[model samples]
Target: MRDMTGLEWFKSSYSGNDGPECVEVALTAEHIHIRDSKTADGDRLTVSADTWTSFLSHAVPRV
Candidate 1:
């Protein structure tokens, strides 16, 4: 795992302000970092930019 201390994490706008279920994401040149917003110091998942794009293609709904 890379040092995430200086990473800028962001949560989805769709996530409710009152919820603990929010997910946070940070992007680096080599990978995309995903972690639980409620547990910033916990384990995180890292994927390549291509993998992240592929996941989003299937995960996001098209208009």
Candidate 2:
């Protein structure tokens, strides 16, 4: 795993203030860190930058 000490995590802007299902994402040099905002101490999901870009591209299609 890569060091994420300096990674800046941001919650999805679309997420509501009291949203139950919220995710936090941090970009690192090697991979993107994804974790549940509700369970920050829980395990995280890491994905390569390229894969993350592709995933987002499909997850949120351009209208």
Please write out the lDDT profile of model 1 over residues 12-45, one tens digit for every residue. 8898889999899999899999999888899999
> How does each model score on TM-score?
0.86, 0.79
Kindly report which residue stretches of model 1 are placed more than 4 angstroms away from their true locations once superposed: 1-4
Runs off by more than 4 Å, candidate 2: 1-6
| lDDT agreement with native, every candidate | 0.88, 0.83
Report the Cα lDDT for candidate 1: 0.88
**Candidate with maximal lDDT:** 1
Alpha-carbon RMSD, each predicted model: 3.2, 3.8
Write candidate 2's Cα lDDT for 1-63 as tens digits. Answer: 223466677887788988879888988787989988888778889999999999999999699
Screening candidate 1 with a backbone cut-off below 3 angstroms (N, C-alpha, C), the clashing residue pairs are none
